[model samples]
Target: MRPNRVSLVMSWLAMLLMGLAGLFGACGVSAASAAEAPIELRQGTVTTTVDGVTRTEPVELSYHWDRQHNGRPGTASFDLPFTLEAEPETPWGIFIPRVGNVFEVQLNDALLQTYGDMKRNNDADYAKAPIYVPVPGKLLRKGDNLLQIRLHADTARLAGLSQVVVGPAASVRNELFESANAWRFTGSVLLMAFSLIVGGIALALWLTQLDVDANGMPRRVAIYFWAALAEFFWAVRMADGLVAEPPLSWGPWGVLMAACYAGWAAASMMFVYHLAGWANERRHRWVRWPVAGVVVGTVLFSALSLQRDEPAWFTAWLAVELVFVAAFVGAFALATLRHPNDDRLLMAGAALVTVAFAARDWLVVRLSDAYGETTWVRYSSVFFGAVLLLIVLRRFRAAAVQARGSVAALAERVAQRERELAATYAELEAAAQVQARTHERERILREMHDGVGSHISSAIRQLQSGQSSSGDLLRTLRDSLDQLKLQIDSIHLPPGDVGALLAAARYRLEPRLASSGIEFEWAVDEVEPVEGLDAHGMRQLQFLLFESISNVLRHAEATVLRFEAGMKGKTVQLRVIDNGKGFDTTRVMPRSLAERSGAIGARLTVESRPGRTVVQLEFD
Candidate 1:
């Protein structure tokens, strides 16, 4: 049992030792690989042989041979030693991180690769990215191989070289790809792509959200629209950093990048101002002119700089951009402090982040005199763009909620107004009914006064004077009662129908006419219905016809009475013809009765001579 326990302990010890050896072996291999990585020459000596005089000086990576250092346009050379573990026939490459103007690479005094042409392509400038030149296996020696580079810088604007690495093709390629600048450039490219996509979405939202206010002015979609424009321009500016060779010449490219920067600044200011609601303020008018002036000046200055070939304009433009950044950040900060809302806070934070990254880039360039293109500004811009997009989406959501509420409120108001209108209509109908009854009462009183009352007064006067016989008195009483009955019957006639009025009159007057030893004839043709004959007008018309017939029975001593009503063209003709001892119509027809006939859209005329009497009424 003791021996078995000892064997188990030994087995555990051996297993632990094996695990530790394996771990150490893995670490050793990793260290060896790291040590064998491509050599980056950060420090070098620049040698120039001009007019048989050679000059040498200690230089570092990204060293600028501008007017301050090496004034004249001449060729400068650099030499570095490279060691290889393998034999001569091994594939090797030299990777240049960055180069300005034109350059040539040489291995052991043999031409390897030439970049740019001084005489023909002076305007050609390389991007601050790696350029790989493969060294032929035959040209490369085993140890201490001399790699020489000759640089010709014609311009004072951004002429420099970053580090160069010499190693195997795979190692050099891997180092070049994994460089800090390459990572930054890749990040910028990714951010630009994201910004472009988000900008398109924001622009679509802005366009679809186009709405008008009550005053016929556009709503606040300008904020989102300008934010999208700013993001797009920022993406366009970043595209320059992603490429190894710009599409345009260096001068034109610089001008275009400056223009994009100016556009971004202008749009950013407009977006912030609109978002903060300052655009609706009266003071914005004054603020807008200065903003416009800054943008215009930026564009014009960039153009002039391109034409004059002045590098100082670039510095001025950068200063202007910094100022705009400061101003925007300050504005958003103030708005956040005043409003203290989630949106304002987010905008303020984004603004500060943008400014911080921009300042960091500017300081790095200014202090180091190197264009550190791998700044955090592009990432910060992407972050700001996301924030702005969120704000715009929130605004759209709020507007949608408000719109739904407005529709509900509007529906309620419409229902309330309909109820009010219906109640008002009902009240008006009741008032109209009352007014019609009042008018009818007045009409009845007038008929009684004109027809029945006058006949009764005549009968009373005849009896009191004893100038009338019993038969005459009885006939007057009977005629007065008949006139009263006819007046009451006219009241029951349907309004606006002259035929109904005439028929009613004949029914009432026929009995009286027969009692007076007179033959009555009613010749009423089927005439078209007449309009504009109201209740009062019909009563007046019936009374007039009854009075005419009564006159024939009481005074004219008519043997035959014929009442005729028919249409004559557009006019209604009403005729009461009597065969009786007629009076002089000129003396008998009253002026008041003629005037009343004219008031009722009718013409009245009486013709009486010897035994024939005719009372004619024509209505149009």
Candidate 2:
């Protein structure tokens, strides 16, 4: 838990940090008196000169400057004189693990190896890298051999060295510095690659959410955006260790690294705020002030790096960054404790462990080790990535469930509407059937009254007047029964059957015509059925025929009575013609016959000429 790491991790939480092996490089490490072990050059004289103040001290296997010159720019020379019995082997090497930022090695005044150019401010952080440089076999002598380590120091990097080991190539390369090399160089590359992949996918998913989904988490699952932003910035910040020849030089690259570091910090806080559902106006400003401070601090730190004389300005910057980091870490820890789930709680626990590591760095500051700002917190960045993924998946599952429910609800509504429509149709059909039955009943009553009732009234009138014979009264009653039979017989008749009425009337009243001494004949033609000539129209036709037959028997006094029916073009014509002592042809029409003819839209005409008369009806 470096202050920056625990804070928004503003210093770039997963920065390429000093190697773990560098922490214990000099502790209890020795080349014992064995034939195969290397020779340990522990005994040496160290000369330090800083700002014109020079001091010399006896050196040990591990050494550092006095605390007074810790952050000052200075130089140190480690003159290590070793006595060898003879040139032990050829093509040997020297292993000096965890030195200052830069240094060089010499054997008998001949420059043997260099870490890098110490005079320039390069992009790499050499304090993290272990030193294993080759020494020539020709430079070694039997006695009075000298090994020198010339070290350069800058701000924040104190004059220091671990033990020096002069041994065979295998001992120096494989035994001492191999594991340190793996952790510092190889591990940094792997972490950068892994973070880049994680960051890239997170970024893509965030972009997809931004482009498509509009609901779910507030601001459309914005936690993914923050998580992606944090991871992407961290990946590039980690590249500071592996990128030896960067695209930009030291000043611009440092500024870039600072921006990425501060950006990661702000994004992580934003992600946490959203995760806890605390991104309201109150807590939002809490994030904003710190972010503003980081922006200002980055600008100031960039300005400070440009000044060569202000080597201690870096310590000032780190001290101020410490204050910002402390406040951020406090707020972050509080929020983490108030997190919603076990996953976030796990992240908090990792931060706490990293805090313990950073606490060790604080307690042992005078120890002047390269584990100053370690990457212990970076070990748990996976927790953040995992939680972001979980939120995205959970939101997607919920959206799917809601969509399915909506479809099911819509289907149910459609089914309900269809059922209602079907019920309404059934009701309408039933109403139409009831109305038709009512109309049919009325039609039957009208037919009985007009035909049967008319005949019964005539029979009663003859009896009451006391002028009718028994045969005549009985004939009128029989005519009433015939009218009822005709009404029933016309029920099965189709529309526009012009001959049906004449044929039925002849069958019923033929006996009467014979009793009256009159013959009856029929002449009708087949006609096509017509629309609108329904059962009611047929009843009207029957009444007309009955009335006309009764007139021939009572008044015509004829020998023959003939009924004629045929189609005259599109019109249907029916004529009742009789030969007897006929009545006057030119006279007012009988109201009963005229009324029914008009009701059925039939034309009634009468013609009389001494011995013949005809009542004609035409229907179009």
- Report the number of backbone clashes for model 1: 0
| C-alpha lDDT of all candidate models, in order | 0.74, 0.69
Highest TM-score among the candidates is held by which one? 1
TM-score of each: 0.62, 0.54
Error of 1 at 329 (Å): 2.4
- Candidate 2: residue 523 lDDT (0-100): 79
Q: How well does candidate 2 match the true structure, expressed as C-alpha RMSD? A: 18.6
Q: What would the per-residue lDDT of candidate 2 be over residues 443-464, giving only the tens digit for each residue? A: 7787677667878989989989
Residue 532 in model 1: shift from native, Å? 5.5
For candidate 1, the 10 contiguous residues with the lowest summed lDDT are 65-74
Candidate 1: TM-score? 0.62
lDDT of 1 by residue, 1-620 (tens): 99999999999999999999999999977765654556776666788654456789876666655433432345678776666554433466777766766788888899898877745433566545457888787776545667778876543345566677876677776656457545666767887888798789778888787677769988657777887898899889878766545677665676777788778777877878887888778876576776776677877777676566454565566677688669867977987798898888888898888888888876665334563245677778877888988987898888889988988999999999999999998999999999988977876777677677877888999999998998888888887888788777766788767788778777777777777789988888876655787776776677677667767777887789997888899888989999888887656675655766776778888888987888898877
